[model samples]
Target: MAWMSLLVAGLLEVVWAFSMKQSAGFTRLGPTVVTLVAMLASVALLAWSMRVLPLGTAYTVWTGIGAVGAFAVGVIVLGEPLNPGRVVAAGLIVAGLVLMKLSSAG
Candidate 1:
């Protein structure tokens, strides 16, 4: 349950981040609202998951998911650059996330 919450939270984090970019520095009303709502939900779920997950593990995984997810969204939806270096960096983050989950999701 906690892991599920954390995963959702992480995904929400990505949603909020992308929405924030769409918000245009909070000038856009619709995206701004989405960003705020997703942000709150993401944090709430993170806190809930923390009740069962180790702090380091939960936080690391949360940020890792958000980071890699955001990168993919940027490249795919936003048409951001897709270079080898960026791909490797994102892959490393995913590897770290998997390792962290293996070691701490016990």
Candidate 2:
């Protein structure tokens, strides 16, 4: 399924993003390799998903998932800040993603 591929790609995007932080500008070998691998895999999956999904809709969904996922990871795993403003912003992103999904379905 294209949607499933897109979902995995979005998750990989989150992984790569977090790995990038750990990479320390590519100075750290292990994290750098992980970041590169995840980045490649995420892009490959995203490209594959584009074969079936609309370009605009797919891209928006991919980035929205990545954004929300990364934010949650930061808060839950990395002990990053989670203020009211961020919560509201994340909610808005989720709302937009829901609208996009609904529109794509019909």
Candidate 3:
């Protein structure tokens, strides 16, 4: 449950981040409102997950998930280049997150 919440929060973080770009530095009203709401929701979910998950583990996972999701959005939606180095870096982030989870379980 906590893990699920964390994942949702992470995804929402990505949503809010993308929305922020559309918000035009908060000059755009609709996107700005959406960004604010999504950010608050993401933080709330993170707080909820923290009740059961270790702070370091949860935070790393949350940020990692957000980073990966945003990267994907940038590649797919924004047509950002997915170069070899970027792919390797993303893989490393995932690998680190996996290692953290495994070590925490043990």
The 0-to-1 C-alpha lDDT of every candidate, in the order given, reads 0.98, 0.94, 0.92
| Whole-structure CA lDDT of model 1 | 0.98
| Model 1 lDDT per residue over 1-106, tens place | 9999999999999999999999999999999999999999999999999999999999999999999999999999999999999999999999999999999953
**Residue 37's C-alpha lDDT in candidate 1?**
99
Q: Which stretches of model 1 miss by more than 4 angstroms?
A: none
Residues 1-106, model 3: lDDT tens digits: 8888988999999999999988999999999999999999999999999999999999999999989889999999999999999999999999998998888741
Candidates ranked by lDDT, best first? 1, 2, 3
Candidate 2 vs candidate 3: the lDDT winner is 2
lDDT tens per residue, model 2, 1-106: 9989999999999999999999999999999999999999999999999998899888999999999999999999999999999999999999998898888952
Best by lDDT: 1
Q: Residue 70 of candidate 2: its Cα lDDT?
A: 96
Best by TM-score: 1
Clashing pairs in 1: none
Candidate 3 weakest lDDT stretch, 10 residues: 97-106
- Give candidate 1's total backbone clashes: 0
Tell me, what's the RMSD of every candidate?
Answer: 0.6, 1.2, 1.4
